[model samples]
Target: MSSEKKNKMPLGGIINKGGTCEDYDTGGWRKFRPILDKEKCIDCLICWAMCPDSAIIVEDGKMVGFNLDHCKGCGICDVECPDKVKAIAMIDEKVAKKG
Candidate 1:
């Protein structure tokens, strides 16, 4: 066999036309939405339809994900869940910072 080496491109070498990586650190701008407990969810679509940002996704017979980037922690989903136990809740930014 001939002695040869294959060169692999560096992962960061690829950048958008703006010369910035898509995965650049956001400096804690993102927020986390409280996940709903399906067993306690009661299949109420209140949170899904009431979300102002349309961040909640219901897919394939399951509540899939919340789009945190646009959520702004408006608490609409939490209040509208209609569960007496209040399964959905707003996790404040301060608490998120510590975690």
Candidate 2:
């Protein structure tokens, strides 16, 4: 290969200064669950039961809140929900950081 051509090729395949890998922050490993629209909820306690962390809570005969601290953001609750429109969603921590 010519000198110019060799220069154009990466040296030792090492990443250059300008190159970047996807940045994944390990700082916030905590996961969160977003509760669904109240109008869409049918009082089915699927989310309350499916949460492995027991993050969901029922209060005063209604599904009230989710304990984000214990939640791992697993999609089980969102998937198992019987509502036509899924009531719960797992939000990505990284995306949350952008806002």
Best by TM-score: 2
Give each model a TM-score: 0.56, 0.58
Report the C-alpha lDDT of model 1 over 30-60, residue by residue, as the tens digit: 4544556666766566788998766677886
Each model's lDDT comes to 0.65, 0.67
Stretches of model 2 off by over 4 angstroms after superposition: 1-28, 97-99
Q: How close is candidate 1 to the true structure, as a TM-score?
A: 0.56
Model 2: per-residue lDDT, tens digit, 1-93?
476566566688977766252242322446644656677777688888887767677887688766655666776878888858676766776
Q: Could you tell me the TM-score of candidate 2?
A: 0.58
Give me the displacement of residue 8 in model 1, in angstroms.
Answer: 38
Backbone clashes, candidate 1: 0
